[model samples]
Target: MREEYEIYEQSLPWILEAGEIIKKRIQEHTEIKRKSSHSDVVTEVDREIESFLVSKISEHFPEHNIVGEENVGNRVSSSPYLWIIDPIDGTSNFINRKKDFAISVAFCERDRGIFGIIYDVMAGKLYRAHTGSGAFLNDVELNAAGTDGSLENELMAINAPWGSMEEMKRWEHFFKLGTQVRGVRNYGATTMELSDLATGVLGGYVQYYVNSWDYAAGRVILEELGYKFSDLNGDAIDRVYCGGILAASESLHQQIVQSLKESSKEIK
Candidate 1:
């Protein structure tokens, strides 16, 4: 218990420090480079912030392994502790709008989350959680309670994908959900979307694909609020991050999962 508290307490400052670095760095001109595709990108600031965090973690906890978006970390370690970080969750958003990006960090032991922190840099909102303890938006404790569990009354966020047969099929599932919900929104930033979800502003999230750094921290925080996670096909996520993701209340989650599976069969 003490160890969990220590992780959160220590990580809080590190994340805040990283946020400050982001604020200063964004003011200066930042160079962007595309990876895999034009839509997927990285920034010099992304590498800088990640390098900054990696240095801190290495200095403080030399035994922990790190997996970061920028790949600037001491990944080889004998200890079971691991750190996952997305120095900037929305590189494109950060590049274009400069306001929607976030810094996400998570610490885990044996693939189980010890704590997670997501800092909405522009909003100055810090969302964090630890296992067994409820999530929090800064000092305000957050819980998943009193939800109607009705898809019609809830707003959802989706990562829209268009291309290929499988991608289009996933898009169809997203469209189906969009029609049922009160509204659909996209932040282009997973951490921000998740912060809102934890606070009940958004009911669920569906992304056809995401990487470990993209959703790891938010996953830990959301799991604390009774949110259930799974692949689009209804299989348990089990900390898997290289595939589709769905997050919602248990009933709503299963509802979407079943609906998507049924839709897939009929559409093909």
Candidate 2:
């Protein structure tokens, strides 16, 4: 395995360099494309950024396995080093110029995350964390807030799709909890939401669908800050393709999970 600090040190420059490139091209007219559905999207800038990052990693560390959102190659490797990249976490926001997008990158060894970097280009914020090192935003160490899982006092970040569900039961369940929280927000960007969680701006984030690239970097940073993540059932987050995700501080995580479980049962 690569030395902990060395991996972080090597990734920091690359992530910052990539963020610069992305920021420069943010104003350009980039081509947009749909991925799995109309709501699922991608842009030419996404491809360009991923290509640029993959090339840099390949040139510098040819042995590492790269898993990118825009480009998923056929070359599967069992190597210890794996680099996960999400060129743009919020493509819709990027295309619409909404300014909530982010560039996410994570390095893992033997499937264990070691370093995570999430750069909010529009906001000029960078959230980075390594295994033992504390999380930081723009070089300032982040102090995570404590929570005791009381739904009444929590501020939750949930996706917009949940509000438009056809069945009123699930929607009502979510609404009931939504009204009890201190507040509710939808940034349309998972990375930013997770970054906000790390900095204590959000009590937790709930989303229905996200890939490894979307959550890996944020997950590492949150974990370093004494936060936790799991499926709705409170199981370990062992895979990258989980659609339903629940992330929060240790205290709030269980409360959210229990609420979700009860809601799921009710909706069923």
RMSD of each: 1.6, 2.2
Give stretches of model 1 more than 4 Å off: 145-147, 164-170
Give lDDT tens digits, candidate 2, residues 1-268: 3476776887777778887887788788787778778878988888888887888777777878888888743134767778889989988888886489999998887668788999998888989988777889998999865756587777789763543456455555566557668899888889989988888778998876678889999998988888888875678876365577889887788877777767667767
Where model 2 places Cα greater than 4 Å from the true spot, the runs are 72-74, 145-149, 160-172
Which ten contiguous residues of candidate 2 have the minimum total lDDT?
160-169
**How does residue 233 of candidate 2 score in lDDT?**
69
Model 1 poorest ten-residue lDDT run: 143-152
Error of 1 at 146 (Å): 4.1
Q: Write the per-residue lDDT of candidate 1 for residues 18-130, one digit (tens) a residue.
A: 99989988879988888999888998999999999998888888888898988887486789888998999989889889899899998888769888899999889999988
Residue 247 CA error for candidate 2 (Å)?
0.8
| TM-score of each predicted structure versus truth | 0.95, 0.91
